[model samples]
Target: MMLNDIAMIAIVGAMTGVTTVLFGFGGGFVVVPFVYQLFLRQPAIANNALHIAVATSSAVMIVNAGWATFQHQRRGNVTADILFPLTLFIGLGAVMGSLLAGQLNEGTIRLLFILYMLVTIVDCLVSRRFLKGCEARPLSMSTTTVGGVAMGAVAALLGVGGSVMTVPLLRRHGFSMKHCISHANPLSLPVALCATITYTFDGWGKIPDSGFIGYISLTTLVTLVVAGGIGITISQRYFPKIPDWWHARLYVLLLIAVLIAMLW
Candidate 1:
């Protein structure tokens, strides 16, 4: 990679790392668009730019999610009871979502992503009333499984870490914002892993020779993962100081920024 490209990756990675920990997302929301823009500048990967961007972002999430999960666990934010039951269903859903993503064209995926953003924005805006009647009861096994599958699929399709959906659902089920984020952090692992593997095989022979394995750019993955890891460490150290209301506001701002970037 050129020095300029390396610099770009480092900068993006650092920003992504902070966001990933701060919001409990896998950083795919930020990574996907940035990587898509970067891929657009590379002729060899231009034809499959969206796929490459999504795949590479998912791959990077493997590292981001793992580290963030560890940090959350250390702080006693993760609830094992909630995490264990959803694993299998989430994995299954991730595989299904990746398969579906492999079959769609770039335009369709982009449109879906935009629509998802709109819905999430609306959900966040009216979240208080929407969750008003929800009981602080334990989620049934069946409900967890179904929710896990759906969350995994959508997350993979959009190149996210599943927290965007997971957090809202958990919140409605009476989980605090912090606990929701904590649980959502670990769920990202399955989605990222499954989607990355699927994308690798889906574009195996179609893309040009561009230092890629299928749709994943090795250089981008390495640089972002390393820099993002550093960002996560730094962010975790200061996470306790941030209030939940501030976190909510930050998430809204993030979604708005991403929406504008995509439209722009």
Candidate 2:
């Protein structure tokens, strides 16, 4: 509500936008840590800082991921055949995950978040499949069923969305870095929607502030969406110019940076 708060959040929003478009994060990775820290200072919500952060991250993703998916669709980067089947299961998992997240204590959620990031960063770094993927192939039913549900569940629980899982999964199927990340947008959309709705009702009247609607910060959500929109528009023009190899490398580096931020 203060000028400084608005400015700082807007900055975070801009960063969220860039990540959403470039890495299919949809503000999940950027918003969670920051919002967690922000809410920690409020006595009323201090104990639930991470909860509010995770829920708000989900809310922000609804717009960021959805819009990014639309843009990706125009570019012919989305694989509908692969996307449709996975999407349904992801939604189911997201509902389950959001419920689970609400039951977790703050410390437990933070630890799990840190551990998940470490594993993901290590996997992306050591895995040869991430850089030079194979030919594009249809995902098997079993793969989509298990992977989609798992991805949505974990993503909703951690508030990181499916980019961390979906992109890597798609990469092995021979998608270029751009296409792999592009596909993540659509996959993330369902997780955001389902998680936000679940948390909204589950967290009703829990946070004492008027600014929050359930566990989500209504003001921050709008700011991030607006700022993220500008960022997405700017990034789209330059996205195709990046080399695939660099894209893969940068993704890993971004993961590392996020890991450090979480720890910090």
Candidate 3:
């Protein structure tokens, strides 16, 4: 890769880190499209560029989500009882999603990703309940098992951390934006870790490339993780200071911006 490529990676990595700390994204929303666009022109990996993008996004999320979860826990943002059980279901779903993804065409998967993102954005905007915060209610067994698993499956398939869905789900269920994002971090961790493992092992010896292990581009993964870590360390101070209304508005705006960028 050229120096300019590295520079672009670092730039996007820092932005990913900022989003992780502030929106609980774990770099998926940013990483998937950026990496796909960057690698699509390379003849060797062109056909599998979307898979590589998703796999690499998952690898990046393991670090971003894990680190952000730790920070959120420190602030008493994570609810342990709900988190543990939900994580189990999400993990199971992630493995399922990862295995199924290899059977899909790259264009089909990309289409799914974009469509899901559009739906999510529209859901948040039209709901009208997202900005009004309420006390968080207990998770029903069905929501924990069925919803968690579905979220994991979809997030794994799309290379997202599931924050886009979780945040809105939690918000609709009466969570404040601050705590919703906090909970989103821990919830995303399992999805990332489980998906990464499946992607790495599933694609090994199959991709026909030197720089990739499975669908992951190790060089890109390492660079993004390191730069994202630095970004988290630097930008975390801005997280707690935002007001709830502004926070919720910004979240929607960010999703809209990402949607526009992806479509363009």
Best by TM-score: 2
Global lDDT scores for all candidate models? 0.84, 0.87, 0.86
Better of 1 and 2 by lDDT: 2
Superposition error at 78 for model 3 (Å): 1.5
Model 3 lDDT, residue 177, Cα: 83
Q: After best superposition, candidate 3 residue 232: deviation in angstroms?
A: 0.4
lDDT at 60 for candidate 2? 91
Give one digit per residue, the lDDT tens place, for model 2 in 1-264. 677787788899989889988888888889999889887887888998998999989999989899888888887887778788899999889988999998899999999999999998888877788876667777888889987899899999999888899988888777888888888989998899988998899899998879888898998888888888888888876656678888888898998888898899
User: How does model 2 fare in lDDT?
Assistant: 0.87
Model 2 ranges off by over 4 Å:
238-240
lDDT of 1 by residue, 1-264 (tens): 579988988989988898877777777888888888887877876768889889998999899988888888888988878887797788899999999998898889989989999999889778882234245668788778888898889999889878888777777677766777788889899999999999999989888675889889999999999899888888877656666566667777888898888777
Q: What does candidate 2 score on TM? A: 0.96
Each candidate's number of clashing pairs is 0, 0, 0
Between prediction 2 and prediction 3, the one with superior TM-score is: 2
TM-score for each prediction? 0.93, 0.96, 0.95
Candidate 3 lDDT tens digits, 133-230: 76668778998899888998999989898899789988987888878889888888888988888888878876776878888998899889999998
